[model samples]
Target: MAGHAGLTTHVLDTARGRPAAGVRVELFAVEGGERRRVAGAVTNADGRTDAPLIERGSLTPGTFELTFHVAPYFEGFEAAPAVPFLDLVTLRFTVSDASGHYHVPLVMTPWSYSTYRGS
Candidate 1:
């Protein structure tokens, strides 16, 4: 995990125009048609996990999922929709190269969300 050769993520709260602090995020490895928990962390004040969800040495070429607890994160906010449009937001992707860095950043609101590969 030296240099930029692991997996990282960032969460942004579009409604608040800031990082989605303290939000729970989970990483899962998909194998044999089943998903198994790999690692998990809560976003810090900057909406980033303290370390790469997957370290360089631990990463392997495979399919993975990053789940963001969207509804729960917005529960404390007053403007959150009463029923919230999205509960858990899961992004599934494949890693063909274990030594390459993967940056998955989420831009979200109570009603909508978007994710993209980042540098």
Candidate 2:
């Protein structure tokens, strides 16, 4: 992972079959039982980060958390007749190895969401 090692993420609006644009994402690192914000950005038109969440040279083996704000994204959707059940979605995972690619893809709707390791 020396060349281009980093963390990346994407969100697919399963309900709409499209990228989740304008979603707010926050990256945090766990330290001594406390969470610290490392970096953050909003998803682009394609629902992918414009830059890697964590760059290669800055990567470390540890636990990380990604919080995605999904409330506003579903507020006006016709399918969301009521307030969304999930407002702030958080995904916590570990980076045991920093030399490999880590792609976290989230499939989500106004009421629920799921994620997994992606290629």
Number of the top lDDT candidate: 1
Q: Give the clashing residue pairs of candidate 2, or none.
A: none
Cα shift from native, residue 59, model 2 (Å): 1.0
For model 2 the local lDDT of residue 113 reads 93
Residue-pair clash count for candidate 1 = 0
TM-score of each: 0.94, 0.94
- Candidate 2 local lDDT, 45-89, one digit each (tens): 999999999987678999999999999888989888576788999
Instruction: Report every candidate's CA lDDT.
Output: 0.92, 0.90
Could you give the C-alpha RMSD of every candidate to the true structure, in order shown? 1.5, 1.2
Worst 10 residues of 1 by lDDT: 1-10
For candidate 1, what is the lDDT?
Answer: 0.92
Model 1 segments beyond 4 Å from truth?
none
lDDT of 1 by residue, 1-116 (tens): 34788899999999989999988999999999999999999999999999999886777899999999989889867888888789999999999988788999999999899999
